[model samples]
Target: MRLSFFLLFLTCSVFALNIDISNSTIANGKTALLEFKKEKNISYEKIVVDKKTYKIFDNPINSEMSYVLLPISYYEKPSKKKVELFYKEAKKQKTKTLFFKIEDAKYKKEKIKVDGSKVTLSKEDSKRASKEYAEAMQIYKTTNEKSYISQSFILPLNTKITSEFGKARVYNDSLKGYHSGTDFRAKVGTPLIACNDGLVVLATDRFYSGGSVIVDHGQGVYSCYYHMSKLDVQKGTIVKRGELLGLSGDSGRVTGPHLHFSFRVGGEQVDPLQLMKLINKNLLNK
Candidate 1:
């Protein structure tokens, strides 16, 4: 899928900058790719979306083509918003704005009865959970200049999807939580693969997630694998896309054995399916 920034905003007023959007209608919890190329001696300093700044990434397919990626948070409301672009030409600073149509998306509600103890945590478990959450959040917020993932990603196992991202789960019809990851049905000892090339940031069994592995794909993007029966990789271990990481099982508070796979971008949970589709579209050049 070529992201043509050609003659964008034909129905709207054109900005003074050379910019084109990857899509006109962007759904919530999705990503947006911007194709941008600087004029001779004129380049952008930063790209702003919803008051947050983003760095420009070089298009791996075409060196001359630069792009900006936006990972819209699931909490973002549907509306028309403006993206600000700041650039400098011949030492002169300038800025331009582009509008995007964002739509709302709904997730499937799920209700499952699990152990009452799982829903209610003790004082010790609460403290441990808090610390673990903070650690994971820090990893998600970490920024790296170089993109560690260069190629396409592969599924951990070839199995049917049993659960989806953003799925809302109500435990015992009381405790509610959102399913921030995608789940694939896999039996015990099913070999799991790393989605892309990255260093293992965390590989340990926790209270809720059980055996989990979080890979830092650099550039504020991370992939997570949870509820594994066995983990082969360690912290700081570099893994390829198809490299074995572990096996999937019902080690956590799950009803059955499955691989709960997910991705985090810019500290927000996004749809793994949409993320993979956008990534595959970009990797078509390979």
Candidate 2:
């Protein structure tokens, strides 16, 4: 009885540690979760592990919650050992908790373990995958669209990010590569807003994106809002900033209700927070 009790206590203590990026043993490019526990907020530079170093991103504006998806090269392989994280804070600031999760082959192929399962995408929908990348590029270049100069991009939905961007995933038993967007957790009818004002070029239900909405915010900046409950705007419709475009829900390949938001500058998928840091929040406040 004493041994069992001790084991239970140890388990609880480990969980209470609240460390992110703990499950790195499963696969590469897994989300590294770390908590910044400190007496006060402090700005430090870089996280160092196994003599390998990583730099902290620089930005002017920031949100309460943020995440980044790194390539597989960011982590060490084999034993799936724990790597140490270092911090670079601009000023001494208090850090409460940081948590992490990694997406592996097993995680991607599994269906929703929770009850009340709803299908978001079907096999037949594959016919409409984005075959017109060239057309999207053409519209992105030829138009006098408004460029996104804001430092902080708004959350496409009102809820928290359920699934992070760039997580490795498997869809329909096929191993998909790195995730391209951030998933916002919300109910079936939560309002989905436009992060910035731009032209609605592509608005269609996709097999994977599901009830997807793509907006070109000029200067080759494009934001894709996916897994919507409903789409209120149409293609070619000019939308204003913060316009009500749709509602958040599980419309695509997902386990629960969330909005998958992705930002593309040209063809590469850069960090959404980078754009957020560039845009001024004062304009939105007005």
Candidate 3:
């Protein structure tokens, strides 16, 4: 009888821990931060939202709790999505689900009448693009156990945005797809800066992306720079916030000289500016 009573008390205490979204409702292309409290030492197993794995990490400076920055896709529809959190419970594990609501966001559509040859890929270019995409996707899909990224992310370019994220993009005469990254109108030699403190994971010129760079800033987060005039960093190089990366230029399928910046969380591409805003509030470096 005493053992049974003690177990009941333990169960009640463990279930008292709190885990909830900071915002109940958020616009598409933004983010939702999951804050955990009352549980000082816990291990997060996995977090799945809308069938996609979200990134989960412990606060580097604070050991009392952890956070998961749920990346809201820029094109996600206005609907309720289910989020399942698997976490440590006692000597075993437990699960919890939350219904997250997403709102629609109006996006601008733009058409570029670029050279037809630029839009249509040759057989050689197609093969190369396939390989490059495969490699990039691998980096996005894998999550590091430790957070490599520092505090809030900085903008790669501070100039006016020529194209916005989630914008419906039409190239030449056919639909290309939604613009996954924000574009900045830049000169051929306009310098680009690193978004945060991260390790250069991939730095090479691709068939479609041109002089490209991918930075792994830990915590299942990554930032990409595309269509650069030059490559200044190499693979495995650790960079600091606001460090010079390369120069912007017109490359690949673009119509003019510009810089493309994108952010990825747990293999999903999200709005870079939106990510910066979300990080500024939840995960700034101390």
Better of 1 and 2 by lDDT: 1
lDDT of 3 by residue, 215-286 (tens): 998878899999898989999999999999989988776778899998888777787887787667655532
Model 2 TM-score, all chains together: 0.51
Highest lDDT scorer: 1
lDDT of 2 by residue, 37-108 (tens): 222344434454445443433221233322122223322244444344444344533222222232332323
> In candidate 1, what are the lDDT values of residues 167-240, reduced to their tens digit?
77888997476788889999989999998888899999987888999998776778999999999999989998
* Candidate 2 worst ten-residue window by lDDT: 1-10
Clashes in each model (backbone N, CA, C under 3 Å)? 0, 29, 5
Candidate scoring better on TM-score of 1 and 2 = 1
Native RMSD of candidate 1 (Å): 2.7
Q: List candidate 1 stretches off by more than 4 Å.
A: 1-3, 6-16, 283-286
- Candidate 3 has an lDDT of 0.78
